[model samples]
Target: MTEPTQDSFPVTPTNKIRVAKRANYDRDTLFAILDEGLIAQVGFVLDDKPIVLPMAYGRIDDQIYIHGAKAARMLKKLKEGLPVCLNVTLVDGLVLGRAAFHHTMNFRSANIHGTARLVEDEKEKYDALVAITDHLAPGRWDETRETTKKEINATTVIAVTIEQAASKIRGGMPIDDEEDYDLDFWAGVVPISTSFGPAIDDARLKAGIPVADSIRKLTSRR
Candidate 1:
């Protein structure tokens, strides 16, 4: 397979910087971090004012898809073809050091900059919504309320080309100065983790309708 194209997001020299060597520019690592993240904060400029909104997103082939109710004012500007940026980040751990100034958090983060385009085609809109649902909780859309023609028309979906992006990662314990390490103090990493639990059945569901295998699998193994 051909290597996916990538562009370095122009980070202003004045922007905050930590461990520069841990910054990753490869497309594969960036995409993997994006895929694991559950929420993306989309940023856009409208009328000289900047706005940021957190929303769910899904990756499709070579594009990133996101949407909101068509009537929502937040998405109105986006649907108007405004340029937008999407960012997803996951904090992996808390790196503590003997020196207070050296405390830091390990993380994996991705930021994508691109012009947003509306999904005007009906079939494409359907597929985009499906991708959004499936990306969050796989196989759940099939069991939930399907989007109606009116609902579909009332929602706005935007697809942005996957370009001008990169992922930055920082992990492991604190990298303290030699003098700081010698100071007597406790220092180590506090790991961060995510887990799913038992499925809660709806009180209204018929007793005979057993939990679907899809959900059963999610809750079966911690």
Candidate 2:
């Protein structure tokens, strides 16, 4: 995710929230969070009406690529050039608390707000689809066959430039109020983790793909 990038999308022009500033932005840092997960919550407004929808995404260069069935209401609405905010967040841990008021979760999140555009170029769309596949499973892009003409025709892809985005991170133990901190109780982080499970081959997996080594070596659980 850290390949050097121009990050042509400037952080200053796009941020609306001051709490979530872009000073901490480093392409490698932000996009790694985007790359580690496939789901994103996209926010948009149509005709003065607001919308936020969660969908799958892939990152290529400085753009966030997302797709949904053409019939998806969010997709249909977003295709109208509405301004959108895309949120990608990963919960890293649950903070155990001495008081309910102190309960919190350690997380990494990025919120991007900007106008989204429907990708009309066939070549760019093809590349974006491959990036989506690669984002889900690294080697699958090369291993899986390309999208069929009909499949491409039916899918809708949207791209959001990596403009002003704020990355907010919360980690470590809960900090209870001064009075509550003295309460005798467990107050530490309950670590949460994400991992890829063993690849499950289809019963009909054809002859010799034999699960590539890249796909086989996964999972923290035995």
lDDT of 2 by residue, 11-74 (tens): 5645433555323455566777787766898877777877677787888877888987777677
Q: Which candidate wins on lDDT?
A: 1
Cα lDDT for residue 111, candidate 1: 76
Where is model 1 more than 4 Å wrong at Cα? Answer: 1-19, 220-222
C-alpha positional error of residue 98 in candidate 1 after TM-score superposition, expressed in Å: 1.1
Root-mean-square deviation of each candidate, in angstroms? 3.6, 4.4
- Regions of model 2 farther than 4 Å from truth: 1-23, 207-209, 217-222
- lDDT (Cα, tens digit) per residue for candidate 1, span 18-89: 557876666677788887888999999888988998999988865889988877887777864678888899
Among the numbered candidates, top TM-score falls to: 1
Candidate 2 structure lDDT: 0.75
| Residue 60 accuracy (lDDT) in model 1 | 82
- Which pairs clash inside model 1? none
RMSD of 2: 4.4
What lDDT does each candidate get? 0.79, 0.75
